[model samples]
Target: MSSSAEDPNKQPTLYDSSSSTSQPLLSKLNTEEPTIRPDPPDPDPEPTQFLQISYNHGPRPFKDLPFLILFALFVLSTFAFGIFLIFNRNPNHGNVSSYTYDTNSSSCVDDSLNLSLLLSSNNWVLFNNELSSSDFLEYLIWTLVVTLILSVPFCFLVLLLLKHYTKQIVYVSLPFFVLFPIFFDVYWFVACTVSSSCGDSFPLLYRILVLVFVFLIIGVVVWIFVANWHRIELTVNIIGVASYALSRNLGLFVVLPLLALGLVFYYAPIVVFLVFARLNGKIVPKESDGEYSCVWRQDSWVPFYYALGILTMLWSYTAMVEAQAYVISGTIAQWYFSKEDSRPRLSIRSTLRNAFGPSAGTICFSGLLVCAVRLVRAAVDSAAEEVPGFVNFALRCCVNALLASVDFLNKFTINFAAITGEAYCSSARMTYELLKRNLLSAVFVETVSTRLLAGIIFVLSTIYAIAVFAILKGVAKLGVDSYFVAALAWVLLILVLGFFVNVLDNVIDTVYVCYAIDRDRGEVCKAEVHEVYVHLPISRSHRSSIVPRPLGV
Candidate 1:
């Protein structure tokens, strides 16, 4: 067989220069300018076309190992402290009774030292109690179950809609996104002015201030859309390809929900720790009114434990989210590099192995950064309430801006990490340089695809919630608590559907990075995708300097 027709995956690999230098790791996929070497003496030498890609085998060295160790230590210490708090009996409560069914009594049951009861936590308690009263907890569980059941088919429907109506959805949703807030503000203002009922509630000055703020926000939205109008076509194409890729990898839908379920299980122990923390406090009787209150023991470590618990929750949640992104990106990158007609079988198992098995530390490191930002935001919010001033407001704005920038950059950084298997810092630097070279701002698609998906999910979830509300109230004869049931349904549907959209967002990032690599290497990994993405407008500065004609041009 001719060398051109040889399986590229079997060829001897060229040593990557990126391993030795600070160059972007993925740039090794293809060199922009090939180094010259003397031709081999073999007269039968055949020209070959190949891209050297290596598959990672077994377990690789952990990236960001210290962060992983720190997170594990925190998890262990928090659980140990929670266990101590639960088992440690309050010396003052000598004979506090264990919680049991006492039909004859109507007072609050004081089960101070029952470790099992405290560990069972609020959810189980609420489930048992609410079963008899309004059955609110039961209804909520059923509502969430129904939402999960419906979300699978609903996501497939969304994929179909996006595939067929990408342009229509973007054009239509962008208008609604812009106009809805404006209309809402205007209607509220007019209602306050015309209706005596609400008119007395909102003072003139307050109403005027709200209107001014709303106008400023709308102005910013309009400016962003107008500025990126040129890039909307490219965004539509990317979303279209993403929808197609998602459709091909239908199993991706399950990956995220399963990850989410795992996340819920992870939180169960944390929830127990939080509940037991409060229960561990001592009961102090009030001197003024003789009422008793559970006051946390005056230990310095108590406050620190609370803070640690919060950080643990946020960090674990963020890490789980990053893991999801990594899995999706890895899967999509596999699909992107495959041949259109004769693509190899893609295995999400391998992708999962790479993401969670080898690169788990990278996910932990990224999650820590996000968790720290959230901690800062929470502190700023508290301070804002305590010290309401210009300086405080300015600080809050600057901090929030920093948070947004990190989040935006992290999205692609994680995607690139998924592709290259590099550590977080190295992947971040490389991803930034690649995007800069391509002149592709991640901001344009962020404004369009995410908002459009969010609008669709919101509308569908709200409609579904309302339909459930009607059934609960009209058919089941439920009372006001039916609203709560419907609201729970709404949140679940949004969460499930939002997970699906998140997969698509990761697909977009993966495709763009793949395209950047394909463009850089002067090879087309997938021709149809390249044809569509090739239309991405290049800035004039780079267009003049040796822009390689896209594959087959």
Candidate 2:
């Protein structure tokens, strides 16, 4: 057996034994070590620990410390200024003055009345003598210093509040509420101090102070607008809600249904007026005496164009006003009417309280009434010479002024009516009552329906008047006895042209309103459901793969 197994030629071939032994050696070598020298130990990863020095770290804390110190200084300065103002001794010791420190001066009391009546009655000189006698310059400086000091704390507080709340309503409104009163007070002090001391000769310091405060006011306004950018969207939404509510509450009774009626009755008549104006053309040119022929041309259609423009403006105003009124009415109702009751309550007592309190509404109303009266008087006086029939002209002008006043009053009154009506009735009952009573009130109905009508009438009358004057002149040149029929024709043609222009305007306005509604609503939709996608770019460190792969497979 040994002989056979050990036989070199007869035993297993060297090729077969060698292959088996080599396989085991290869397997051991592959298992024990990598062939590529293990990437030279990765260079110990280059010592990644680093010192990050940030300038912002120490500087941030230090920066805030100065602001805090400045703020504290400002508060102390304000306290000092207040004490100075309260206790400053009057230099003129012998003058027993009747000047009462009245903080409760009625702001709503007519300024003109106070100037004309109280100042004259009390024998108070337009310029108080005491103001010039004292250290007025010092007081002015003190005023400015006080303002600056107060503003620092105020600005700091505003910044803190804005940071804490992070709401647009507070951010926008708070600054205005804070700044307006401060600036108003500063202005009051400056004006009173200046008028009392220097009369018309305002000091350079006063002017500088005014300019600085103006700039500050502007900055505050800009900041408010910027901070409350998001609130603009809210405002627009509020406007839309208001408009819809108005349509639902007021339109069904007063405006829309009446508008429908006007469209049915007056619209046709207006269209006819336009058509007549279009058909009867006026003289484009007329010749005068030979040597220098006078070229007489008439813009018979110009009145129509003016009319149309006016109508468009009026309609736009009415729409905006109505929407605003709805908003006011709803807000008032929610705030004053609906609380702690099954039905809405008027709370006349609260209303009276607000009227008497320091609010803008009473001031605005009184101011507006006074201005309107002044305007009417001025208009009447101005038109006295130009009008052919003075009394009739005055009456017409008065009527126009009265109509405008009514429109102004209507804005507030309609809101009042809606509130009061809602208070008296249940929501269901109120809705029905508002629809019924508001519709029947002819003045309200007609006013809402015919916002554009007055414009149309005024344009036609103006055009007719111009055309008649032109024809009278032309006839006088031709010969004063030239037929009246021709002059009448010219006037008719002018009126017709005015009507056409008005109609064209109405059509354009209708189209614009439709487009605006679509655009506004479309914006609302886009804002509501718009999708935004965010993408983060890959950094260099993140680009490396976790596992290594063979270069060429």
Candidate 3:
């Protein structure tokens, strides 16, 4: 037995050994290698490694490069054309020896003054002189200075109010929004009836038509309110969230205004060019005796140049607005993604850099698309006016529908681009897909918020304007047409208020897009916000696993 155990060929079996030898067998089985032979290795040793490319969360490659190049070319061409017009002006090209650059002075006077005053001062050289005088300019400058001084504080106050009292403002404004249209339509109907019955009486059918239209509008307004009742809460929350974001990023106020002011300065020279293009015409005799008018030269490129300047203005304006939206969206997105404990790297300057640097091409591309749509719509509308028929009307409707779709798509595309730093087409594609997935949610957000926010801005702006006018009345000595100056101030105030509201609107949009992204990724960003927004309409198939936590007080 000892010899058998010592032999390597002999196997250790429990049956052959006594109870004491069982331990040795077990130890041998545990310590020794297996009896079964290993299978042969495969022929190839190297394995394939898969790589994935995903949407960038950081600065991406410059997108819409060709559009950027085209934008540059447009600017250059516009300036070149303006220079050509300035240098190559020929008085004899159209007809006469003299040139008159003041083509719009009469129209300007008519537009600037009230109707009664305009009729009274049709030939009032003194009135025209007053308009062009240095003293009047001084007064205008003073009014503007006062308005600017007032507007800044007022805008800041509006921001504060929006941040702290968003729900109150929304609740207060919705009634006004619903009522104003009805009130306006009713008042107009009454005025039209009175005007027709008392003075310059027209057909009774006209009044009937007006009454029917007013009723229809009022009905539509009521229906809209009833339909969107459930969404009001969500809209308010969205605005509240946006207000919170804006309050946190207060520097945006200064940056956006500066950008708008810069755009104004840029367009000043373009206006001069437009004025010069008007001067590139020849003096010609009118049909009336001892009368002359400037007939633009058929051979001259003035018309083309004028159109180009107008196009540039539209494109540039769209680009600036998109850029603002981009900045706000990006800044808000950063705020959304940042962890509560981590030091915030969110800077408006960095966002601005991203917007004007790598993302500029995207902005330009979106702006170009919008501008093209607007131009097409304008052209179609003009043609429709010339040729009034069902066919033309149908065509007009089709064009309008197309333009509206583009405009709507362009808005969210910019929002997505700002957030992801993606190219224009890529951003648009993603945004469309995202919205498609959450169509009802997107519609709910857009429909419920726009009217209410617009109402709030309008009311606040009007109140601010009225106060500004009162201040101007007390301070300024200009006796007559003070309301005109007040109206100017009012327009400026509206623009300021509109801009602030636009920032908030962008914030709302960005939040929605970010929420969509987080849900898709099964990540919870800004858990507090998610708690509020997760109640939005979501399809069963696309329901996310991101569980919202209870909000901390």
Instruction: List per-prediction Cα lDDT, in the order shown.
Output: 0.74, 0.36, 0.72
* Model 3 quality (TM-score): 0.72
Model 2, 1-553: lDDT tens digits are 7543645565543245545354444566588885665555444432211211111101111112332343334334434433443344232221113222223551111112224345564655535555555443333344345434443343333223322432443334434444544665566556656674654467667766876787777676566556755444433233232223222232223332343354356334334443333333222222235222212232355355335533433333333333333333433333322223343333333332322232223222323343445456666667766766967686877777786765544443434323332211122232232223212112322232132222333333334444444654554443332224333443444344333323222222222222222222232211211110001111233224222122122
Pairs in clash, predicted candidate 3: none
lDDT score of residue 506 within candidate 3: 83
Compare the candidates by lDDT and give the number of the best one.
Answer: 1
Better of 1 and 3 by lDDT: 1
Q: Which candidate achieves the best TM-score against the true structure? A: 3
lDDT of 3 by residue, 155-194 (tens): 7787787778878877887676656666756666677667
Model 2: pairs clashing at backbone N, Cα or C within 3 Å: 277-496, 277-497, 304-498
lDDT of 1 at 372: 78
Task: Show how many residue pairs clash in every candidate, following the order shown.
Answer: 0, 3, 0
| Candidate 1: residue 479 Cα off by (Å) | 9.0
What overall lDDT, based on C-alpha atoms, would model 2 receive against the true structure? Answer: 0.36
lDDT at position 23, candidate 3: 65
Where is model 3 poorest over a 10-residue stretch in terms of lDDT? 45-54
Report the Cα RMSD per candidate: 14.3, 34.1, 9.7
TM-scores of the candidates are: 0.72, 0.21, 0.72
